[model samples]
Target: MRVSGGSTGGTPSGGDGRDRSDPQAFKRGRKVGQTVRGRLLAPGPQGLFWVNLAGHKLLAALDHEPSLGRELVFRIERLEPELLLRDITPPPSAVDDPALLLAALADARSRFEAVLHRGPPLFAETGAAGPNAPLAPLAARKRLFDWLASTPEAAGLYGRLRELLRLARAFLPVQAGRPVYLPWAFPGLDASEGLVTRSGRTFTLRLFGRLAEAGRVSGIFSLSMNRASYRLSLERPEAGEGLVAALTSVRLGHRELAPVCVHLGPLAPAESGGLFAPLIAGAARPFTGLRLRV
Candidate 1:
């Protein structure tokens, strides 16, 4: 296997014991939160560059232009199946101490105190647009951070605070006339094939697959639903079961809107001929979700 770095001096397997040069393959070994020190390469299109992070040509998209060839430290932020890092060298003290990182988050928390709320747009409702109100969890975490700061346990609160910030960002309120981007799905355990989006009372679900993406029919399943009884069927794709998940539930400013459940039977692909079919459609079958009123 071809591994890139000054020299790790060992064969790099693609984790299931296969030696391949796939960038995504070598990238999976590293986890978010781990720090890497590497040199930046020249910029690529759309503000992406290649940096040698922890002995690999890690891909990064930094806000500012980094010196072409300077050794720098970065903290892994999100694993886009690749690597997204942030400059941790601003305060070299934070390179090793999570407490310093927590301090940095605290500083950012102060600025994010007026972004989102769990329900309707508060600013529009009250016409009070200021930095006084923050997202619910963000504010809660900030207060918890202050309380923790006074205790001896303050030393180990970085992870908790970081995650709270991530969730807040992930579920950031989808504003009117804006597309709702779902939370990041697990590498293999998640599928967007049969996902549904609801705006007001109208539901739009994408269907059918592009014939060019998947060569032939893989499998087919049938599903039918109603108020009294329901039936489901599944025809796993060539890629595997490829079932869908609703774990990343979203709220669209309604009192009765809530996620029904997680994992469900696979949704068969629907391809009755279309130009906008998904590359790898679900089988000859399909999938769905339920909205409950209490």
Candidate 2:
């Protein structure tokens, strides 16, 4: 006889005097005394420690004071509403140093600016189509991660990134069951392309020149890669224009991220062909639309 409900607290079953340890047979059951990483969130209504681990939000009752927003390893014990956590332990090194996190965020902002200031807008001044587009940038960013690993700069914060590597690698690997999340805060990147660089506060207009077409002007073009997502767009200052037909493609490091033509709205022949060369040259498969375990 197959028992849908077990003898006791919904234990793993069909408990009819037989072992039902078949994982594929039923829903997953957590084994007692398993170690897992946990990130502590803000306090609850009762000031209870709220933790997130392996995409599970759990409550942790610790033997010692806890640091908020920091990840710690915890042992799991079964509980009804949520899992019970014990033996909570901190990571070996400090990973939440504010200064270093800020530096990393700042550096990323600068790289965006560098691309904006690489030169006049790619398509603004040239009609160099049919095979005359600038190549991809040599490097998108200085190896901030590599530098942190090798040097003592941002020692405390660097350690955090290192600690996350075990988890972080899961996100970008060619294939994996679980997806990874970036630790740093993402800044707002608006359509204006306005950025305040450390060297000096300045505004950059990528357009070298703009031509008026039938009471409308368009010259803004941008290619952006966020994590593993690649996006290319051509804008006309005014709306309701016809689509421009042309052939375009992007290749990154031997991978054809985008081997297709871009269609835009009524853009100059010269401008449309030349504008996206940099992005295509640097295009590679991005890390978006990943299915998370959650």
Candidate 3:
């Protein structure tokens, strides 16, 4: 969702004094049977719960009291007389299951790779040409959502990937230590950020995605306390001299920074295999007494 301001407080009231903050009215264009993601805000009067769904606060009656500030997923059961939501959020134990984590990581990697192969341009603009350039992270996210609207399937995949990543970040410590995956605006592009080796101030990140025009692209970005720089490696048929030419003059604001672009001949598997290597390695270890039957 696009960033917005202001906070909603107190219970909303209708003319008849009944609570007016019904979730049905603020479904955010979602229909019944569709799942909506929200966070548990606080308990309301009369045993109702206040929830923040898509930036709007609505009241819901829950069977069990979920922890405050916990993200929840609910399927819209009804929208007529009253809005009913079924809590579909997975249990913490299930989220921490190695099998589930591996499946999620594999699914995300495959989906991202598929999107990179056939989806729209990763960036609104490649910043290949001078003047109008690629957007910053936040603006890029807005553009990404705007692009995803036209492609519903892609948007759904993005939502699932985002949820899985969030769950992984929250529940899986082994996978979260290094190469922590965070949500990126561009579909199929897994971006990870962490501190550089032996350096507290230097941070590094890598982005992998495909451009409709550029085939497969991998980018590495390094940022220090003051300076930032990036290198983009491309793998496309028939050579990308023109695309490279356009990228040479890319700008990140008013200041022009030199970005290195390398041609890696043909793309090599997109690095999806290594995305969850650590998790897989951890999960594959044999238990103390576990054995397979012949």
User: Where is model 1 poorest over a 10-residue stretch in terms of lDDT?
Assistant: 181-190
What digit string (tens of lDDT, one per residue) describes model 3 on residues 36-135?
8888777666667667876666766677888888788765555655566556565554365656665665666577546644755545544332333331
Clashes of 3: 1
The TM-score leader among the candidates is: 3
Which parts of model 3 are misplaced by more than 4 Å?
Answer: 1-137, 145-159, 170-199, 237-243, 248-258, 261-274, 277-282, 285-290
Model 2, runs deviating above 4 Å:
1-28, 77-83, 91-294
Best lDDT among the predictions, by candidate number: 3
- Which sequence of candidate numbers ranks them by TM-score, best first? 3, 1, 2
Error of 1 at 63 (Å): 1.6
Candidates in order: C-alpha RMSD to true structure: 21.8, 19.5, 9.7
Per residue, candidate 1 scores C-alpha lDDT tens digits across 142-221 of 44445433432221233333433332232223331122111111111111122234555554333222212122221111
- Determine the C-alpha RMSD for candidate 3 after optimal superposition of all C-alphas: 9.7
Q: TM-scores of all models?
A: 0.25, 0.22, 0.46
Name the candidate, 1 or 2, with the larger TM-score value. 1
State how far residue 59 of model 1 sits from its true place (Å): 4.1
